[model samples]
Target chain A: MAHFEKASSITEWLDQRLAITTVKKVMALEYWIPKNINFLWAMGMVLAFTFALLTISGIFLLMYYQPNVDTAFDSVNYTIMSEVGFGWLWRHIHGVAASVVFLIIYIHMFTGIYYGSYKKGREMIWLSGMLLFVVFSAEAFSGYMLPWGQMSYWAGMVITNLFEGFSPDIAGGIMNAPGLVEWIRGDYVPGQAFLSRFFMLHVLLLPLVIIGLIGLHFAALRIPHVNNQDGEEFDYHEAAKLYKEGKTKESKVIPFQPVFLSKDVFVLGVYLIFFFYLVFYHFNFAMDPVNFDPADGLKTPAHIYPEWYFLWSYEILRPFPKDPGLIAFGFAQVAFFLLPFLDKSDTVAPANRRGLFKYWFWIMIVDMIVLTVMGKLPPQGIWNHIGLVAAVVFIALFVSLPWVTKNENRA
Target chain B: MKNELKILGVVVIFTAILYWGVEPFAHTQMHKHVDGEHFAYSDLNESTKKGNVENGKTLVMGAGACTGCHGIQAVAHKAPMDAATAVSAYGVNPPDLSTAGGLYSEKFLANLIENPAHALKVEHKFDAAKGKMHPMPAFYGAGGDKAQEIADMVAFLKSIAPKEISPKNAYLDACGRCHANRYGKLDQLGETPTFKSETDTLKHKVAVLEYQDKLKAYMGKLPPDLSIIIRARSEHFLETFVENPQSQLEGTSMPRVGLSAEGFEKVKAYLTQTGDPSKTAREAIGPWVLLFTLVFTVLAYLWKKSMWKDH
Candidate 1:
């Protein structure tokens, strides 16, 4: 009962576990972070926090989830509805945490790009980060299928069918292979095979890969440190001086330990509240009832909408004219994987940036927005023309921006 | 160095706790169980009852065994009059017992089932005028005691028969083996036959106003042609044909009718005899074929074991 009676024992325990060693202490809180970093810098921590939250919530959710087609949807419902000794609190936390995870990552990515965080020594970090992004998308999608609802089933159909559009050269002989289709489909249609495979990918294989890759990402981040908004390296001495001088004491940039931990708790609480509201009060939040039915090739759902993340992409292909739009759609989807290559920023900070590539960068953004809108809208005559123009402009800017940025940097 | 040790210590503790205490709780292996939604007709309210149609199912499938040429209960297929097809297929022009008795009375059917010769007198007259009766067997053997059983079966048929027989069922029932295209073959027949349409494919289909005429013509019998196949003759005569056809009729040029229990009942209900019994010497070849198959399987297994003996 008197565990902390002696302060020395507690201090010794803390020192053995959490305290920084002398050598590592030299590269402590004042060593890497920039002094003038803004709220945008908080995005990375938010992203990290989101990942941790998701992992915890995910573990709890996995307790009750069944991953087969016949049971997947019901398992999810049970978790949300009947597994209520815990007030369905864990499920809500997980559901909300997933959306927040995406929200934080999106913010983090845009912050990195806008501030040119992908430059120089940070390239490995950016690459690892991009890989993490891909893994996250895959994890989300596989998780979507585990629910085995109507949206989940049709979404799997829609997304998997996307691979069909790939040229045989790129798609390989897998699709054309005999019995491969049966393997993918499991039965003659989407049933136990698809759900169970997706379940394994979502819960087991993908998560393992994600954990390893995330470790690499963090290691890479440690190599060069977090890139700041101003292109120069952090003036740590000044930051330490300010911290000692009471200036940072009152500043918004708080220490990550206690203060940010509390903030994360608060944000997590907000997310939990919303999650429960949806799970219990509106459990069918992201679901479509029609998706509950088995997939029949004879009947198609009236409208197929991709998950929210792919909405922009889906919108891009919709209004595309038959001939050029097909190619445009291909290029647009391909561009998602090609994003890290498309934006060429040689500097880590915006303050020291110099380039004639800004125009091309703006053009890329405009084109993407246009393409996204085009994909969302139903096909019409003028929209088709706009889509054509958007596609051409997107291709132009996509190719030109990196070249222009690199050239100007060289100059 | 101290900071590094501290960090390493923390990481070790985290991983140790995770791997030991947390992992098992995190990984709760659960399997999916579908909430089955089976519906029972017996459980339904009076207004909503699908009725004891299953009785007809038993008669057609169990005693009748109409599935030989027709498809199984779950799988829909057109059936010929052979045994296996009779149990499975819903029947082309064969009249699905699931809904057949609505058009004809049980007594009327029982009378017909008693004697195919008496019942098919009209069609036989037609055939007689054309030439000789089509070697059709006289089936009415129920005598006096089994008439009510036949009537109950016909009642079951009236509840479930399809309103219309499609060209697919009719073609499959009457001429599937010999013909590929129902429309194509019918066009060549030079008759512009009334049964070639999309609707008149099944024998006891509800939509048919002239189901009796079509069924009589298809069965090669006449109105009130009961011939009591279920009562007079060995039930196995119908049962074997309904369950397995190739055994009952050797080189039997009958179309493969995939008759479901409902279809068999409808046909049975449609066929109960009305006149005196004319006992014809009909042989049941099913037992011989069954015995042959069993011996053959046993011999095949023995041969297989002998082949593997050297190995």
Candidate 2:
């Protein structure tokens, strides 16, 4: 142990024991941020805000939500929406946050890729962020099942069936895909067992995991610091020292507090305006119309599609025959995590400064949008061909990344 | 700054394309728009346009005999039988007609008065395949063939109806007997009755179940609750389907309840209220919330500028 100073006040007393002053210094006040970053850097804070909103609203919803199959639909549609005061407001906030968080995640993700934030020493940041993304996806999927509605039932059915891809022939016996599905569902179909388990995962297990992963995600950021738009590397310690010495204009970095937080607050204010607009007036996109119908095992809806966030991968899985589609989907899910290794370019700069990488980035984005659009459409006629082409392009783009970036030089 | 503009431009273009593909383009591909003209009851519309309300009232009270099973609450025209007796006889309670004028289309009412089976589009139930007759008989006893008399009856119902009926009242009067509004706290028989005793509650429960069973048998399936129907269906589809059930779903058990355009609007409002009750408050508070955020953003921008002024 080191020598301790005598405490003078409550904060001082607490700091003597808990290192409160050190924590505040390390986490916020003395934390250095690149001054060259733009509004996109604020997305991380926005996502944290959204997660807080989701957790709070989810707790409120859990108070009224019944997990039993017989009563779950009515509990959500009637009891929560009609009976509970401000229940609809909580629901709207939860719903819009759930959806809009994904939009921000995608933007945050692409921003990282464009700025080469996942390269060199920043791999852990990318890896931890991807882990958080996966956990968030699981949280969203499990929460979706709580409604016990037509879309909920069918989407659950379709997604769980993906486990079937694991079953393979072995020694004159077929592995039971159906049996695995039954074990996961706790029945042959989605019912009381499915509902209860998903409810537990959504409310308790997954949320705890998400909170833990979020901490890790931020922790991973501390070591590498944040990447700048220009991808210009400099000594952060020297820049921070210069900022401290009142040479703020000469310094390339600024303290995270006051300076960085001001810009973040401005971005958050803008983001909230967009978010509340959706929450209040245009929430239909977040809550599917077909989901209003109670779950029926026998009656399948005319069209079934996952939420928009998952559409790009869903489209990738759609056009190909089962096994091939499954393989492609598996690839798409893990592809982003492999970005650090796949982009062979030595330079760490914005895509605009990289020759072929710029085109690659833009094409990847357009291809993803195309896949998402095709995913929602009925896979027939012209749409089938378009989806097939888009899916092919998606896989081809990932496969070509290494070759495209290998010979590229910083512009 | 140039890079920010470039990013913004890209984002705007990308979002616009995505919206077009998802909303308008996807919609056209998924649902084929049904033409309302195909289901329009032209002759009935013409007759109702020139109906005599006084003559309609006399016919309903005397010869039309609508008062035999149905009650017009606004005029104190009670049904001849009690609800229990009516349920046993017709397998469903006859809805009150106090708001029928505001709840149903004139054409639908005129057609229903003339031929319940034909107007409701449940002709399949009475055909040789099913070998069953509708509980409500055709109005053959009094000017049933005369379209003018049927139109007059509709006009009378309309005349007696309250000018400004609530959405809940409109839904209960028009559809409550056959369909439940579960989210709105209504059973198949409108409001769930509160009984003073456990036995009375038990009796009500049994009656409701029995009524639902009878309805299932009569129509091949119990009607779905209308709590979320507004969200589940598009306005055009609902309008066309209400006008004539067979036009959208061939051989659907649902009758063409023929709501006049105004009645459909009220029913839709009720459904929307139940399905998305927070819509009103959400929309009302949206502008203020946006304004507050805008002001905060401006203030934040100014603070950011001031903080960076030294740098």
TM-score against truth, every candidate: 0.48, 0.93
Model 1 Cα lDDT, one tens digit per residue, B1-311: 36435533643453344233212221121111222211111211222123255454554455334443233322243444542233123222333333224333333343344433333233423254567443433333234334443444444555454566443343333332222221132211112345676666553244232433433344443222122223323334554454333344444334223344444444443332111111110113334434554555455445534432322
Candidate 2 ranges with C-alpha deviation above 4 Å: A1-5, A166-178, A409-411, B35-40, B43-45, B48-58, B83-93, B124-135, B140-148, B162-164
Q: In candidate 1, what are the lDDT values of residues A119-161, reduced to their tens digit?
A: 6777787778878887888898888777665567777877665
> Top model by TM-score, which number?
2
Top of the candidates by DockQ: 2
For each prediction in turn, the share of the native Cα contacts (below 8 Å between chains A and B) that it retains comes to: 0.00, 0.83
Q: What RMSD does each model have against the real structure?
A: 24.1, 2.8
Which 10-residue window of candidate 2 chain A scores lowest in summed lDDT? A167-176
Give the per-residue lDDT digits (tens) of candidate 2, residues B1-311.
68776886777688778767876788789876678954457634345256789988988888448887888879987877766677778877787888888767666777788778777777786653476778787776463547777777888988998989898888887788888877787988669988899999999888788888878876678889888888777778877887777878888887777777777788788888987777787778789888998899899989998988887
Report the error of model 2 at residue B13, Å. 2.5
